[model samples]
Target: MRGETRTVWPAARRVAGGLALLGAATVGYGVYERDAYTLTRREVPILAPGAAPLRLLHLSDLHVTPGQTRKFDWLGELGRLVPDLVAMTGDVLSHQDSSAPLRRALAPLYAFPGVFIPGNNDYYVPKPRSPHHYFKRHPGGPHKGPALDWDGFAKDLVADSGWRDMTHVHDVLTIGGRRLDVRGVDDARSRRDRVALVAGPPEPGADVVLGLSHTPEPRVLDAFTADGVQLTLSGHTHGGQIRLPFVGALVTNCGLDPSRARGLSRWSAAGPDGAQRMSWLHVSAGLGTSPYAPIRLGCRPEATLLTLVPAR
Candidate 1:
């Protein structure tokens, strides 16, 4: 009996040590993936025949801190692209001091015309919560935290940077010498999106129409589809934040399905006649994670450069 006990104890220790090593390695790798900033290039078919392609840069979920030099550097590098338009589907801040870093990171891109809408994180600071609650009871509307200075940021964003703060607004602007219709609302996950106010078909004869939201809730997408929006850009899922090999995204953290957590997918609203009105939807995996839960697995942080082409 004594000899058998000794053997079991030795084997148990070895197994426990192996598990500890694996856990440490997993955490280290997750951190590495979080920092792996990447850019995804895709083509958006949403223009008239013979119309020139408009390069659009979609940015989201910045969640910037006071001095994240690495992220800011990457953002600065993107200025070289000189895209025709930029869309900032928000969550642009995670810390009280994030505004400065956020401004520095995006200053380069501001040179181009852009549109923006706020995300939940933009208004409230991210707070740590029980892991299970991340899926079961993730926050919405507002939670306990210090407020971010979004007003100051928004004011300067329009007056100084020339970017349009498109929250809850519908209007037309000229881009690429063509009329582009844009409509966007406040963060939908927080129940702030008042889509009905601006709900309608694209401005008559507008060359292109686009919608923006921080969260890709199904109802919002349906509204955009109903309105004939050519393409809609959004973020807030963080590409499920943690992905797996074949399983892909485990959770969307929003009403969106796991499969469409990131990248382009067709969206539509059901027509009364059992028809589907399809519209283009591009949900950026986004460039940063919530400051409280700063980790990534198979999912890398990202932005997307969408080149609008003529639909066949």
Candidate 2:
């Protein structure tokens, strides 16, 4: 009996030690993943026939905090890509004091045309919460935090940058010789999106109609698709921030399906003729995490370069 007990005790200790090591390794990996900035490039064929290809840089969910020099340096270098257009879906700042650094980081990209919309984090500051909250749908209610001065942030960003504020408004721009009818909404997570303000068919003679929003809510995507918007871009899901192998994103945090939380997918809506119309959807995994939950797993912080080629 004594010999058996000693063997069992050793086996138990080994099992416990192994679990402890695994937990430590996981936490370490999460920390490493936070700073693992990656650039993802994808070729999307969505242009009209005979139109020249356009290079688009999709940036989102920066959640910038002061003193993240590495991230700022990385962002400052993105202009070297020389994208024809830049689309920033929000959460640019996590703290009110982060605006200066955020602007500095984005300064290089000002040379190109860009457009932006605000996310929940942009309007409200982030408060520390359990990381587990990300894995589940946010309980519906008002988020608690000090409000941010989004207007000032927008003003600063647009001062030298050609980026347009597309929240609750529609505008047309000529880029790469194509007339882009761009429409956007403010963050829907906070119920700030006034979709009706910009809801309608694309302006006649526009080459392409695109929709932008911070959260990839199904209702917004539906409205955009119904109005002939051929493509939509969004962020806010963070690709579940911590994904699992094989299973992928654990939660989208919005109406979007978990499978479509990141990367490009197809959204279909019934057209005026009752025919099914499909729109291309691109949801960026995004570039930064909330300062409180400063970790990532399986999903790396990313900025995407989308080459909009002529459809075959």
Candidate 3:
């Protein structure tokens, strides 16, 4: 029995040591990949036939704080793209004063016409918690911490800078020589979304119709689809923030499926008649993570530039 015990102990120690090294390596890589930002570009066929192409830039889940100089610089550089319209789904501040950093991150985007709504993170700060909490069906404790300065930021953007506030409303605008019927709701995760207020078919004479939200909960998305939104944009998944090789995202942190956690995909839901309706859905992996749990694995931070061309 003593001889057997000695052999088993050595083997167990070797396995434990190996696992510890692997865990350390993973943490190292996640930290390194956090700042390894990239831009994802895609072409969507949502424009009218023979219509001139329009550039649309989709940015989301900024979650920016001070000292992230690299993020500030990269965002400033996107001005060269000169997108005709910019759609920012929010999560802009991370509990900082946000006066300078918010301006530093978003002021350049205001060079063009844009529309945005606030995320839960914009209303209050996220408290530090274990990463494991994220995987559970229902995370406990207070999700929000200190209050953020959302009103000041809104005034600066909407009142002063001419950007539309798309929170819980639908409106029509002419952009790039085409009529656009745009609708959006607040962050759906916190039950702030009021899709009923903006519910209805696409407006007449609109060249395109779309919707936006911070969290892409299926019910909100389904409502948008039923309302005849041809395209829908959302963020807050962060592409699971820690993807695996073959298995991919273990959880989306929301009701969204793991497969469609990030990037472009078709969203379909059943209508009243039980027939399936579909629309183009683009979920930004997002530009940053919550400051408290700032690590990424196979998924890198990203912004998407979607070139909208004529429908096939």
TM-score of each: 0.95, 0.96, 0.93
Model 1, runs deviating above 4 Å: 137-142, 271-275
User: Which pairs clash in the backbone of model 3?
Assistant: none
Residue 28 error, candidate 3, Å: 1.4
Rank list by TM-score:
2, 1, 3
lDDT of 2 by residue, 1-312 (tens): 999999999999999999999999998999899889999999888888888778889999999989999899999889999998999999888987988888888899999999999998897788877756766676554455888899998988888686899999898888866789999999987789888898888888897788999999888888889889988999999988889898999888888899998999999988777888889999999989888878889999999999888888
Which has the better lDDT: candidate 2, or candidate 3? 2
lDDT of 1: 0.87
TM-score of 3: 0.93
lDDT of each model, Cα atoms only? 0.87, 0.89, 0.86
lDDT of 3 by residue, 2-95 (tens): 9999999999999999999999998899889988889899988988899888888999888888888888999888988899899989888886
Candidate 1 residue pairs that clash: none
Please give the lDDT score at residue 126 for candidate 2: 82
| Model 1, backbone clash pairs (residues 3+ apart or across chains), number | 0
Which TM-score value belongs to model 1?
Answer: 0.95
Residues 208-275 of candidate 1: C-alpha lDDT, one tens digit per residue: 99999899998899988887887999999989888889988878778898999899999878654556
Q: How many Å off is the CA of 78 in candidate 2?
A: 0.8
